[model samples]
Target: MTVHLFLGPTLAAAEAAAVLDAVILPPAAHGDVYRAAQRGATVIGIVDGYFEVMPAVWHKEILWAMREGVHVLGSASMGALRAVELAPFGMEGVGAVFEAYQRAELADDDEVAVAHAPAAYGYRPLSVAMVNIRATLAAAEERGVIRPATRVAMLRIAKQLFYPDRSYPRLLSEASATGLDAGELSALKDFLPEGQIDQKRADALAMLRVIEARLSAGLAPKQVRYHFEATIFWDSLRQDAAPLAEPGEGSWMQSALLDEARLHPVAYPLARKGALTRLLSRALSDEHTPRPLDDETDAAILSFRRARGLLHAEAMEGWLRANGLGAEEFARLMESEAQVAAVQRWAAPHISSHVVDQLRLDDLYVRLWARAREKQRLLEEAGLADPDLAAAPLSREELLAWYAERRGEGAAPRDLSEAALQAGFRDEPMFVRALLREYHYVRLCEPRER
Candidate 1:
């Protein structure tokens, strides 16, 4: 139930701390929110974030955090920008800055962008944010400190400068060029101390108060309707941001495990292809490996654990720990499986077009071709050419038992329907049909006795 807040020049640490009991951190950048979410922050408040000279906080990561059940809220500066864009997706936006952005009154990001000093210097403001300038000028005019035309001239001057070069001194230094009322200009300058409104700061503080109140009232995790797609990029980020994902007590990384696998000739190529599928899917940038429907992912996960005899919670935990994988990583593996299955299902009909070519390349053409020819001849002679399982006149259990016996396996599972789907059949009926064919074919091949 801890809350993590990213704060910077928008609001000083002391001011934010007074209103909210939060683990305050520096302004956010790419991956910061993700790291916070992974660190178990139930609530995250973003006030200021770096956008230049460093990668900006990503929308995808923020969306990912919310999906992970962290209540992510934003306001002021970069937070306002992100909150406005992500509002429809359940990111809570607070304060006047958020409201202005939501209403479309503020369009350019520079309206809140400011040049600030380093963290050691408390992220001291080196330039004025345009939003503050606008707020200040309007306030000045309201109090008769300046005329209406003076406000317009000042706003235009401020807007013309780049964000880093914007400051009160620079704005006033160029005021003589506009040929406006000298008296009004001087009064506006004097009034800026009292009349200037720091909108970004105000909004940041307001957001802190909102978080405090929500915490007192018992906050809930953010809920999302959309499923988060775990592309390879996401996997990379997760690995990079993890708290040193080690294999056992050996301090071994996953790559070390992969290297060990690569040393084994038989496992290398298969492992390589599995890794390659993940990479190839990512390469198709426009079509990120699509996330399967929730039910599909859940079913795939269940099937995977069942196949590995890891259905129990304790067994599953042990397996994940042995592999240096967490719950999220396991789910990601299931996602990849689902994606591959989905693609294979779509391409199933076109598979026969190149089946022989593949078989030939693998040096299985001669034996397979011969077996197919003989089987067809024998089936035609026996009048079993279009063998249909529905009319096979055998019970489901009899067919399953007969097939399992021939395969030298134990009794068939109780949930044969699930097993069917896992084996790529459309349903239990189709699986039964295939089993019946294999059963009769095997018996026919048995040498006639006595």
Candidate 2:
């Protein structure tokens, strides 16, 4: 199994390589685990990660990877935090720091957070973490270098200091100024030369050893007990990771599309909004095109193959190769095409070219959306006087009557079924459910506005 280790500060790349000869990456940021999983790494060991500099790795992405059958292990820094959070889902947590987190001995993230040098410096530690300070103080107490009370005082001082400003000299100086006995401070300073503990480094090394042992043992991928949900967040990550359209056009990705929208606001903002509306419609299962039968899909595929000179199995394989699609994916594409055809057939009659042209000329979408918002605001303001009226449910008969009263108006549909269709409500229950909501709003507004 190929092992990918993300490490920094707690362990250098070269040092980590000696312990486990894997593809070593810098500290993980958001989406790194998802990318690693996409690249087909069988095992992922996360020892360090950035938190404050940017968005931390999302837990959903890790859960998605585990669902994809990748064995993930964590320890030391950010890894320890993530491991404990996801431990019930089969993420392995190694080292004392991880155990501390699991046992609830360590709570604050600042306990493991520290400032470090850049990648050029192999992520050399520039500040001490609270965990390391706690470990050293515990060791000092064991050896009688400092009394238990003095150690507690020193630890409190260290913990209170910001992560970037934490160091032994600063910690000891603070202890002296804050009522810790001078003799105890002196003893701590004396013991520091040999008693200081690099607990983060130790935990990081332990994680590496754990990963190395697993590699040597030829371990199989761990089975997760829970089923992974492909939530909206996880699906977005998958979409963001798709290969670019061409060599120089940048990635054909959702993030890139958002960037383009931001860069050229006038050109893409409305387009992005439309795309999102459609996507949300799909998510709600309100805009699903009809799917053809297996025989129909097969016929469509065969027809396309013949038209493209891919009549033989070998020729079809070559076409699939050129298109970078596996056989299964190609089959799915044919099925999708059939669904699209059904959608076009179903929509062609409803799509009036004259209406579309007039709407565009009038900038109807912007004006209509704004007017709708205004009406909603006015209705809500009026309803605020009687909260019980707002909470009251409207019956189906009331909804139909309200629709009949507002027939052919901007807010209500000329035909009730057409109204449901335009609203992207697939079922009658949902359509009535929505109309009941609108009925209350219209009824509340009529008294005040009229």
Candidate 3:
């Protein structure tokens, strides 16, 4: 009787492992639940799962699993949300969180959402979940630590902030700033350290106990009444979810294509570095989302089309056909592209802060610094700190040609601002100004250094 549990910051793996006889996995992403069911898991319990960073666990996957005779249960955090949604379909829910969702008292996903460190840190929570804060406030009110009005004001302030930025200290500070009953705020702050309620933890533990009780009572495989339709969308999701397992290993996976890329002498390093930035950007972008997920996805699609010269409908359709990509698949791809663009836009300026550190690490700092200092000295001595390439005896084409040739780049960009971002410059103006200096430095000071 094999069981699998999807858990994360809501409860420690060690604590869940001690109580339940199940394979404890990290937070459930889009394909995780489906993959577990395919692996012949008898029962699956979800305590916590990814809320924003990656594709979420799908409702259809859970329904399909139940139809396939796998008992699926959810409570606390993402589990609670899913349980309220899929309860009519036979998935059992436990604890106050699930009940709250079921009762329609909570609708927003952020109520249970929290920012947390990576798994290496035991998925330690970095921010407070709204449900916990609400519970804590209620407890404070009951104990006469704060008045009812204060609780309302405090919750409003907490809700005003982004989910990731939410914390007890920040909430109290905001209350203080807004001048909402100083004495009550002070009393609530004092009450919070000891009296703070971790509703997510409590709900998660209740779910584990329920799972234990059901198992002790001998759980029969779920016999769902609803017929699960395997649509083309479902088929595509299944294909994407399939693990790239090697021969004789039923579950362990690593892609052969990725291995080939890693083996490439020239491409490997560049690919690895790009992948690292993309991963970081995706994580950051997930939270910010740049207005809304749909809008972000559309914006990414626009950028992608611009890059590939696929802005025209005819050209886009042709490319889509060539790639054998349907509308659904294209939309999914754009979702990921959105994350990349969002990160790039926000980090363009701040990312350069590490330019010196990066150069030092690569052992190129001294050479670059010496060249920069020499350039500064020469330009200043010439009484031309900001050398204007246009004013120089050089045509527009000549300047672009020189810069392009020196940089080993392709044709000059039509939209220099976009190119600037790709090159890690703040904007086209900055890139153009940098080029002006370099062009003059090479032309006036040194003939050329090969």
Candidate 4:
């Protein structure tokens, strides 16, 4: 519903008023047209001559608008060229304002012509009529009122006559009356057919060829080919097809294509295999990664875990299984562990020592599993039975009970508590054990008489 008007340097006050909501003024000294399109306006208008001669800025804006489904209209200067070039994409270009005005004279119906006027030229019949045919066709096309062939014919005439060499007054008069600018001739060479094929048809074919080349070059089928063609069609007509709610919202699949491109080779079977692998991998993965809950969400999740007696390692593992957190689900949650941890820390600023102890136990359990796996591999290589070493594994509860009993009897230093031992194990367990064995090897504790 947003119409963006593009105001040329010579845009009149009345013309500006006609398309106030639909207009986009030309970029300021340091501005960009594409950036303007990103702001959500839907139509752009450029004066006829400006687009043809100074095509740099005009072409960029025109191209951008077409790609983004924003409509572009041109009259007077650049209008003619744009009408011809952009017709395939649905842009409308009028020949001259004077031509529409002349049609007003011949018909002797000022009201019809006035209604037909482009809101820029008032009481100037020639200028009004010049742009009238193009504007009429534009409106008809937009409204689906005229047949496609009828619209094409009107556009063809505008394309042939509304150019630099033609007389503005005569062309406008002829176009207004006949809806064709047939007689105003300067250099007929400029209007001559470019080749055997119609220029517009040829341009469209050329774009298709470019798209095919990109596809053949291994550019993603979704991004460089499909979306590119879709963008062209949308841009040609200057229409916003849909809204992008966020940076990667509508583009996730397209953006994923880049990941596929990176992982796959550009050549043959390997490329095919890699793509298939990636696709299957994604398909097999969980739908959403677990994110660390935000402060409130984390608190909720942690409270749930605690209420269910799932805070410790063994309990958490059982909880995960009972809740159906399999490999795929676990993979997702693991991806968000750091975030979850941050959220938990932020939410529970005054967590009890019991909760802290459970967390440490959970961490140590993971470390123990890793160490067991590593040690098992070493033992297997050394021709030893790894199962024997793995048997009778120390449980967190048992380790804590052993530490508590020793501490109660004053038989171990405070630093030798379970938490300290776990920390020491993580930091330098082999060194600590070597020092212990040197001091206490073969030492015996005497049994006290009951």
Candidate 5:
């Protein structure tokens, strides 16, 4: 029952860990929930997240996690924002910030946003969130430190300022600039040092306490009412968040291999057809009769291997390596040959040039099928793939030169831009980024053959 928490800024990692035992992560982003679910976390708490500098966590990823039976909890910072949007879908929301969002009292995302330090510095906050300022002003009015009208005036000023610039000093300065009386200003300033409310931090702490209580009582996995639909975009995010395949293999190895096949005319059509056929077989499999394994499994497997020219022990081993399988894994597949054969038979009709041509005519089908094929092939090659061997970063100039000379030393491109376009990139910069990523991936691969 491991619990994972993505937190930053609102509460320090040490403070969060003190409230609830959890694997504390920096902040939620893109695939954080998906990856946490993959890691077998039963509960997930999102406290903060990345937005301005990079992509924020996707809503579908949360839905996907809930579908997988992970109890997702949200409050404070990004959590509160996501909770408001997803509460109807089963994400549990905690604290005032979440309530405000749910009631549409705080419609803007910036109400909870704050400038914070880098992860290396423990994500120290540099500026206050608007929600905190609003809470502080409300508290001040309640405490009789300021008039209700003065509090309202101060709130308006705070709201007008950017979230990152909404510090106590700045808020007070703005209040003075807006004709706040000297007596009231003095009262507000004196009260602020110890009386200012940290709404985000309070909400974060409250959420953690809730988590702690639930854990102590042994809470069950959450069940959402809505079905999670895997959109292409969702699928892409999942792939990006997916754990490395086998040791020494990264998630992109299959795509890279497909890219390799795409460059060759003989393999391109075949890869496309194979990809489409595989998808078709998977979609239609539910209608087929059950094909349980029995005594004849081993013999049937041997015959199948022999038919594919894997007749000798060495040939069989080579096939296993290329397909990223261990002997034990190959044996398991052999035991389930009937099921495999059924799918293969069902897919046979779709593995033709005519069908592939029709699929290609539909651009979406072509792209999806290509991605599907890449995934399938990479899954097969995961055991043999070595990510560590290719983990070095390549410079833009180096990548351009490498692309130009990939075929042969003298076959360089007319220019960097030409080379990039020829390599299927939208532009030179995009191409350079891809090349660097690929170079790094390849460097991470293991040196020894599988």
Candidate 6:
């Protein structure tokens, strides 16, 4: 079977003897790992502590291999480092590295341990290599990399390195006596950064690659693409803003539309029509008659409503006034026209007959108008003055804490609950959660729980 190996610049000579059909070196010589795989070479990588130092780029490479179903192996130097990282990517292989100075290995002219010597850290020279081998085997069996086994193995190795017990410490100390120093041992921190295990960049990139692979393998494009876009947008926004709680799921725009629909269906349609007409008019002229609303237009309106708070009663009233209807004229028109019958006929094709019968269109319109007016008044009152009442821009941390608080206390606004969160935010929880987890100052948990 064809395989890809990633080798460190230092271990090129030793890895050259491997039985693979071809080899590719790291600090990528010419084309990237993807191009190497395309050329039918089994890619091998060797490096020192790649997991700790170059995780973003390294993880991307692993994801490319896993996505393309390319087999991978590494050893010695960075090979050992990569082996540990590859556990989560479902790569497998066997290799060795120099023992620490304190280990029981004979010293060489280079001051590194002999190839066959036991590692100073109480594990064999191939400990990291063995981890990769097992990971690969497990992935092969499962027919997918980044499986539960990979996650578990990666986590296990991370925990061992970061939270070693007495025996491990003693073993490491002995290994250090041979040659390994605090610097080398400390490199283990690459497995877990900043004490947070779940938010590793490798894991995030791996998950993204897995999802992309699944999508390419015949998953529905519409759903997959939508989710991908949403994830990217949320991540971008999180990066741009300081950590703060995210607004509820539908986004301000979406919630605004739903609120408008619930409060004033007839008024909503009119306001929507007026908004479109005005937008078009700005592009053309006041005398221009906009084209009839189409499905695309409806969808755009809905999307805009979700993204921004639009279609409130006050806004609708302003729209109506601009369209030549005064408050008194609007009231007269409602009172005189057969609004219920007109709405029922208009909604017949789109909604159930039973629903049309159940709904009192006239009453809904009146109630919605009143509520919209009230909201408009509130907005007016808060305008440029009521700082606390206004919706302030949140930092990334605040957004995450807000999300966590909602998650923990089950107090998320109706519009921003789990289902809505998934729909609106998609895969952005990690980035959002990172900010919350990193800054304890951002109070995401409910006060009572804290």
Give the best candidate by lDDT. Answer: 3
Per-candidate Cα RMSD to the true structure, in Å, reads 24.1, 21.9, 14.7, 31.9, 24.5, 25.3
lDDT of each residue in 1-450, candidate 1, tens digit only: 798999887888888888888899988877889999988899999998876545678899999999989999999888999999999899989988899999999899889887554344455566789999988888988999888988898899999986756778778877766787889888888987777899989998888888888888988778899888999988887776666545464546667877888899879998787778666544442264366876566556655665676543335545766776766666677767767666555544556657669789999999988977877777777777677766776877788877777768776554485677556676787787667666666667887632
The 0-to-1 C-alpha lDDT of every candidate, in the order given, reads 0.77, 0.73, 0.79, 0.39, 0.73, 0.36
lDDT of 4 by residue, 79-182 (tens): 43444455555655543332343344322221111111111221111222223444545554555444556556545555555221122343444445664333
Cα misplacement distance, residue 226 of candidate 5 (Å) = 1.8
Q: Could you tell me every candidate's TM-score relative to the true structure?
A: 0.54, 0.54, 0.57, 0.22, 0.54, 0.21
Q: Write the per-residue lDDT of candidate 6 for residues 129-224, one digit (tens) a residue.
A: 222323333443354323454345443443343111112233345445544445534443332233222111122223224333443465321111
Candidate 5: where are CA atoms >4 Å away? Answer: 243-450
| Tens digit of per-residue lDDT, candidate 5, span 1-450 | 899999887999989878788899878877888999999899999989877445789899899899988999899989998988898899999999999988888898888877654444465676788888889889989999999899888888888985645678878887887789879889989998899899888999999898888889988878778877778888789779876565345669878987899899899998787667555555555677355344334334445543465433335444666787765566556545545455554444555566567677876676867765654455346532323223434444566567556656653342354344334455666666565544443443435334
Error of 5 at 351 (Å): 78
Index of the highest-TM-score prediction = 3
Model 3 regions lying over 4 Å from their true place: 245-450
- Choose 3 or 5, whichever is better by TM-score: 3
List the lowest-lDDT window of 10 residues for candidate 1. 280-289
At residue 166, what lDDT does model 6 achieve?
Answer: 14
Which candidate, 2 or 4, has the higher lDDT?
A: 2
Report the CA-based lDDT of candidate 3 relative to the real structure: 0.79
Of the pair 3 and 4, which is ahead by lDDT? 3
Instruction: Kindly report which residue stretches of model 2 are placed more than 4 angstroms away from their true locations once superposed.
Output: 241-450
